[model samples]
Target: MRHHVILRVIAKLGIPFIVLFALYVQFHGDFGPGGGFQAGVIFGAAFILYALIFGLDNALKVAPMNLVITFIAVGLLVFAGVGVARQVSRLRRARRQFRRRTASRHPARRARSRDHGRRGHDRDLLHLRGPGPVAVEFLIGHYNYWIFIFLMMLGFYVVVARGNLVKKIIGLNIFQASVFLLYISIGKVLGGTAPIIIDGGGPVTYSNPLPHVLILTAIVVGVATTALGLSLVIRINEAYGTIEEDEINDMDQEP
Candidate 1:
C-alpha cells in the first residue's frame, strides 16, 4: 500500500513537470542546439514514467497513440510544406525581376547578339536559381527536417499503436534514428567536408562534428531504453498472457 502511494505521488507531480520541460527543450532548441529529438525523448520519458506508475492504460488515456501519431505527422508536414512554399515564391519573384531588367533595356542594346546572349544566359541562370527555392533550402539546410519529423512520428505511432511488444521497440528505434537526420541537416555547410584531421587539414572547410558526436551518444541511450522497454513488455506478456493494452487493462480491472 505504501509503494502504491509512492507511485501515485510520482504520477501526480513528476509527470507534469517532465512534460513542461520537454516543451521548453523543443522550443528553446533553435536558440541553442537541441530540438525535436531531445524534446521527443523528454516527452516520451514522461509517458514512460506515467506508464510505470499508473499502468499503460492510464498513460494511453492521457496521450492516445492516435493523437501522438497525428502530432508527429503534422510536425513533419509543416516543415516540408514550408520548403515547398518558399520554392514557389522564389520562382515568381525571380521571373518578375528578370522581366523588369529586360524591359528597361534600349531596343538597340537588346539587339546586340553578344550582349543579348550573355544577358539571356544570366537571366536563365537566375531563373534556375530561384530565390524562394534557395531561401527555403538555406533555411532548412540539407538534412531535411521534414523527413526526420515524418520518421519520428512514424516510429512513435508504431510503438504506441502496435500490440506486439517487440514491434513497439522497433518503432522506438526508428523514431530515435530520425533525430540523427535533423542534427546532420543543421550541421552541414556548403563546400564543407568531414572534420577529420587528415593530411594537415586539406582545404580547411568542414562541417561541425559536434552534432554528429552528440547524436551518436543519443543513439546509444535510445538503444538501451528500447532494450529495457522490450524486456519489460516481454515480462508483462508472460505474466498476463496478453500484450494488447486494452486486454491487459481489463485483466487488471478491479473485481
Candidate 2:
C-alpha cells in the first residue's frame, strides 16, 4: 500500500474533502438531512482510507488507540448524560403538572390540555386540514409502514438466524436503519416547513426538530456500537480462526 505513490497522493487530496464533508454533515443536520452518524462514518472512513494508503502505523500515529478509545467512551458518556438529563426534566414537568390544584381544574384547562394532546398527535402524523376516517385509515395503512416493518423484521431475522458474525452486524445495521426511518416518518408534517422563525412568516406549521436531534445522537451511538462490534468480531476471528457462530460453538465443544 505504501509503495503506491499515485494512490497515496490521491488519498492525500481526497481525505481532507472527506473530512470536510463529514463536518458539513454534522453542522448541516440542524437545517437538513445530514447528521452526526453520517459525519462520524465519513470521518472514520477518511482515516481508514489514509491507513490503507499511508500504512497502519502512520494512521495509528495520527490517532492512537488510546485516544480513539477515550473518545469513544466520552461520546457514550455524553449521550447517556443527555438522556439522563432529559428524563430528569420530564420528571420535573410531571411533578409540576401533578401539583396543580385539582379544585381549579375547569373546562378551559381541559380544553388547553386537549389541544396539547392534539398537537402531540399531530407531531406523530401529518395534521391534515380535516383528516377524515378514510384519510386517517389510509395513512395508518400506508406502504411506508409496511416497508419499515419488513426491514425491521428482516434485520431481526438475520441477526437471529445468520451464522456469520459479519452478517449479524449487517442485520443490526438494517434494524437501526428501520428505526431511523420510523422516527423520520413520524416526525414529518405534510405541510410543515423548517421550524425557523422569520419575520412576516404569518402562520406556519413547523415539523418537530426534536426527533431529528435525537436521531443524530442515536446515529453516532449506533456507529460507535457497530465499530466496537466489528472490533470484537475481529478479535474473535483472530482467536477462533473463524467468525461463524456454529464453528465457534463446535470449537468450544471440542474441549
Which prediction has the highest TM-score against the true structure? 2
Model 1 is weakest, by summed lDDT over 10 consecutive residues, at: 106-115
lDDT of 2 by residue, 11-113 (tens): 9999999999999999997877557767888998999998888888999999999999999899989989999987777876676776585324432343334
State which candidate has the highest lDDT.
2
lDDT digits (tens) for residues 156-195 of candidate 1: 9998998777788889899989988877765565577755
Return model 1's CA RMSD, one decimal.
Answer: 17.0
Shift in Å, residue 63, candidate 1: 41
Worst 10 residues of 2 by lDDT: 103-112
Model 2 ranges with Cα > 4 A deviation:
1-6, 18-44, 69-141
